[model samples]
Each structure stands twice: as structure tokens, then as C-alpha cells.
Target: MVLQSNVRPGLTQGLIALMAAACGFAVANVYLNQTLLVDIAGTFGAAEAEAGIVTTLTQVGYALGNLLIVPLGDIFERRRLILALLGVVSLSLVSAALSGSLTWLIVSNFCLGLTTVIPQIIVPLAAGMADERNRGKVLGTVAIGLVCGILGARLVSGLVDSLWGWRSMYWISFGCMLLLALLIRLRFPVSKGTASLPYRRLLLSLGPLFMKEDVLRRSCLSQGMIFGSFSVFFTTIGFLLQAPPYSYSSAVVGLVGLVGIGGAIATPIIGRVIDRKGASFANKMCMLAALISFLIAVTAGHWLPALILAAFLLTVGTQANQVACQANIFSLSASARSRLNGLYMVCTFLGGALGSYLGVWAWTRWHWTGVCICGMVMIAAGMSAALGTKNGGNSHKR
Candidate 1:
């Protein structure tokens, strides 16, 4: 097995910045629709429950793409593979732009999720491109872009849709994807993959690897639950904000994401603690913080200030938990980074998809409080798994 810092070539700042932009743009697709969910439902004359499928299916597609497309990074030339995926992503974005019906929009969004797996590919590429000295810095810079993309997409989409129309915003996204694809195809360096395994064998190895790696399993469980809890809130926050207690516009709903930037800023601080102490310590603290976030969010239905506080805590805790967990899991195998990432993302997003579906369901039945309870339950379940599992186990052999 090759170590990432040893075999993979380090990257330049210019390349890193480009990669950061690409990562943000790709990830923003899934999240851009969160604040726009209300307007979308209104457009199609659908219920909140039905419109929630947009987020749910998009997340499910992301999980599917992670499982299927991301593993190819280990099997193919990274640059060519990325460009190919970007081509398909561009097509999906264009399809989203042209969508006339809710079903069409939903289908287009799912495809967007599938092809937008580019960021996952890019992350391992960034890791491959960084040496020990700048590894964290490179990754952190790119990560901030991704965080901003996730939060900022809402504001852009909301403002665009409010000013122009929903279709126009998607058209803009479509053009951006096309432009990025062309630029990357021209500029990205060619890269050879390190893995020697055949396609079928590589795909088959994941289950056993999951069984064998305690760190991977524990991290997946902890991250899955935490991310699920996080998704539950995002999927339903629109519902809460659009109703009578607040009656905020979709544009106003999107502004709430600005609040999450406060959380994104805490990432470096969290990383420092992880370096000094351990990922386990950081995750435990995040779990407690998440619990508090959910508790605070219970009042968000009535109080906007409480809602802002809740969003900050949830984003901060979720970010730390994700970073800490990935650090633990990725430490297990450098050679298998792509496949390990595929598995990790699949687990995480499966939890996210489940949470999206159940969150809307809970909101339908019991409103905002139900969503808060779900978040707390996920935290409890994740903590239980973390406590029950052993740490520092052997890495898997393929």
C-alpha cells in the first residue's frame, strides 16, 4: 500500500484554488434547492411533503454516485475521469434548467446529484497533491469553498428565483457547469491512478473492508448519524420558515444560510484541537454541541434569534464531526483512498437521505418539534455506537 503523501504528487496554489471552486460548485447543486423548496412547491401546486422529495432524491443520487462513480478514481486517470463526469454534470444542469414539471425537475436534480460527484473525486485528488507540510492547508482551503458553496448556494438561488425565475437560476447554474468543464478540460493535469485491482474485484472488496475496519465502521456510524441529523434540519427548515409563525419569503429563508458561515469559520479551530488531541475527542465534543443545537432549535419555530443560534451550532458541530471522522477513516489506508471514500460517503449520504425522508415525514405529522426530536435521536444513536465500538483497529487488506 502506498502512502498518499509519498506516491501522490503535491498541488500548486493555483490548481488548489481551481479545485476549491469546482468542489463548491459541484456540491452547491444538492443544497441550492433547500431554500427554494417552498417556491418550487408553489410553482407545481404541490404539498411540502411532496416537494421534500427533491432533497431526498437528490441526496439519494449523491449517495449512489459516491458508491458508483467515485471508486473509479482509483481505477482510471483522474483528470480524464473528472472531465468526463463534468460533461455529464453539465448535461444534467442543462436538463434542470429546461425542466417544466415537478417530476422533470426532480429527475434532473437526481442526475445532477449523480454527476456532481466531481467534488468527491477532487478531494482525493487534492489529498494526493499535497505533501505533509501543506496537506492540511490545501484540504482546508478547498473545504471552506465547499462549505461556502453549501451555504451560499441557497442565497444565490433564492435571490435569482425571486428576481427572475427558478428556471433562470438553473440556467445560470447550467452555464457555470459548462464553463467550468471547458476550463478544467483545458487546464487540469493528467494523472495516473495508483490502484492495481480490477473493476469487479475493487467493487466487491468494500463490504469485507467495512467488516474488517473498526475505525471505518465507527466513523461511518458516527458521521452518518450526525449528517443525518444535520440533513433533517435543512430539509425541513424551509417548511418552518414559510409557515404562519414566521411567514418569511424564500429569499429570506436563503439568508439564514449566512448564519452558517459563522460555523464554517470554526473549522480551523476544530482542526487544531484534532491535531493536538485526537479525532475522538473532537467528535465527542461535537456530539454534545449538536445535542445542544437541537435543543436550541426546538424553539426556532417561534424565535428567529434561537433559530440563528441553532443553525450556527448545527453547522459547527456537523463540520467538526465530519472532519474528525474523515481524518480517522482516511488514516486507515492511503492506497485505498478512493474506495474508502466511496464507502464512507455512501454510508454518510444514506443516512442523510433517510433523514431527509423521515424529517419531512416527521414535520408533516408533528411539525418543527418532530424534526428537533429526530436530530436528538440521531445524536443519541451515534453516541451509543461510538461508545460501544472499539477504536484504533487494524486497516483492511483488499
Candidate 2:
């Protein structure tokens, strides 16, 4: 087995934990608006439809961050970039917590989304730090932290919103972001091997990546589809659970997201499998899990147990497939891994923006069935995209 040298010598596992936590906290900014949409709408005297725009704009901000901000990972020192973005996120959260109108809230959410690229930078950094023999494990560990952060955000946001008010969640996250930024600065070693490309070349090189690399293209598409489907579920679930048949509280609806932890836990295991046996087998199984989850969800009305199980399977499958896609991309490009990640995540977040809008539209039009159809079709589209690439092979640049 081949081993990759640690990017920095004398880096302790404790520092790695701190780095991953920073990424986790940073990424959690993206979803903080989702669980609180209703409360936010009422607070701002906006209609539910207008409040939905909060989610859309935040996703749009994330998409923009990926396209415009994350590419800088190749051109700048990663630690400085991470800390800078953390500062942006911290400030944005503070502003969001203080917003007096829907418009101001939306603007702040967009800023938060645009600046929250720390996870994207950190994930590739972690992969590069470990050798092929343990890359999957290292990625898995970081991914676990990220997954928990993503899920935990909803839980903490809900609990805090319940006690202090929804706005306080942002204030709390603001504090977390500040502490994380300081800890990362003091603890994590600087990445000595940061890509030294000029910004012009870094931006222009993405053109060939799209035109030439089938792996980059397909992986981006697959993640987009999976994330799109996932977005639809969470976006519209609030509407469903709050409607006539269920009428669950916001906290309970948030608890429902806890089911997604199954996927968080499954990510590293799937990473291990992708490490041993190529993604061929795992990809297909993940797709199957998504399809099955959709099938069960379509039939589950008033059957709370069935609906929760379906949600679990759907999240687990999507997250596992996402890890596989990232692992494959990392395997393909040693030098441009961060840019590759930036490209894929940008596309995925774009898809999520589209999905969240579509889910709300579908729910408004045809209710839960509409959202379910959106999920199934998107997942199917993702599966077809992955199938278009060679299953047992790797692509190389000339």
C-alpha cells in the first residue's frame, strides 16, 4: 500500500479535529434558514412564498460561493482563505440575527451562503493530507464531522429557536464561528503545498475540466441530482408535517431530520467500501436505496413510521453516493483536487437551488406528491448521469 506524507509534519490528531469542526460550523450556515422559514416569515410579516425565497437566496449564495470563492483555494493560501471566509460568515450571521425586515434577512442569508466555503476547502485538504491507503478513512472522518454539523444545525437551531427565539440561533452560530476561526488560526498548521496557480489560470482551467474530464462532469451531475432530491425532501417536509394530518410543531419537524443521521453514519462505511471495491457496486446500491426510499415515501401518508424510515434511507444513500463521487474525483486529480471539488460542489449547490424552488412550487401546486415526484425524477436523472461514465475505470488527463 502507498502512503501519502502528511502535508505538515508534527500535526496532531487534535488539530485535525479542530479543523474539521471549523469546516462543520462553517458549512452549517447554509441550512440555518430552512427550519426557521415559517417563524422568519411571520416575524418579517412576509408570506410563506416570500419567506421561501430566503432558502433560495441562501442556496444561490452557496452556488456563487462555490463558483467564485472556492476556486481561490488554488490561488491563495488555504488557511488564510478559510479564516477570511470564517470572518465573513461570522459577520453575516450577526447581521442576520439583527435584521428587522425580510429583505435584510434575505441579504444576510445570501452573504452567509456566499462566505461558507470552509467545508469545501477543508475536505480536499484532508484528502490531500492522507495517502491513497488511508485517504478514504481521512475523508470519512472529516465527512462525519461535516454531516453531523449539517444535521446538528437543524437540531440546535430548533432548540434555540424554541427557547430564545429563532434569531438567537444566528447569534449563537456567530459566536461558534468566531471561536472556530480563532482556534483554527492558533492550532492548524499552514498548508505548505498550497497550489500556487494564478487566479486567471485557476478560473480558465475549469473550462477544460468541463469539456474534457468525464469523471468531473459526471460526478458533479450525480451529486447535483442527489442533493437536489435531498433538498426537495427537507424543503417541503415542513409543509407536510404542519398540515392537517400531522400538525407537528417546528421542534418535532426538526426532530424528524434526526433520521438523516443514518446517512451521516453510513458515509464513512461507504467510503471504506469505495476504497476497497470501486464505486461500481456501491453506486448502484446507493441509487437503489434512493429509489426505494422514494417509493416508500410516495405511499406513506399518515404512516409516520414509514415516512421516517423512507427519509432515513434516502439520506443515507445520497450521502454515501456523494462520498463515492468525491473519492473518485480525488483519485483522478492529485494537483487540482480543490478546484475539482469547487467545480463539483458549485454545480451541486446550483442543483439544490433549483430543487428547493421546485419543491416549494410542487408542494404549492400538487402537495406532497409533487415533491415526491420531483425527488424521484431528480434521483433517476442522477443515476443515469453516473451510468454514463465507465463504472470500473478511472479517467486521466493528457
Q: List the residue pairs that clash in candidate 1.
A: 10-129, 11-129
Stretches of candidate 1 off by over 4 Å are 1-9, 132-137, 388-398
lDDT of 1 by residue, 1-398 (tens): 22333224446556777887888888888888777788888899998888889889999999999998898888799888988887887788788778789899999999988878888888777766665334444555667767778888888888888888777777788788888888788767887788888889888988898898877888888888988998999888878887887888778888986798766676656655655566677778888888899999886547999998898888888877776666566667778778887888888888899899989999999999999999899989888756654433311110
Worst 10 residues of 1 by lDDT: 389-398
- lDDT by residue for model 2 (1-398), tens: 12224424443477557656876788788987788887887797887778889998898899888888787876677888888888888889999999989999999999999989889988887777776765665676677777777777777776777677889999999888888888888876677435677788788888887777787888888889888988888888878887879987778877887778777788779867876776655676787798888898988845899889988998888778877788878887778888888888988898889889998989888898888999999999988877776666742111
Clashes of each: 2, 2
At residue 60, what lDDT does model 2 achieve?
89
- 260 in model 1: Cα distance from truth in Å? 0.5
Best by lDDT: 2
lDDT of model 1 at position 88: 82
Model 2 local distance difference test score: 0.80
TM-score of each: 0.92, 0.94
lDDT of candidate 1 at residue 398, scale 0 to 100: 9
Model 2 clash number: 2
Q: Give candidate 1's error at residue 80 in angstroms.
A: 1.2
Give the Cα error of residue 229 in candidate 1, in Å: 1.1
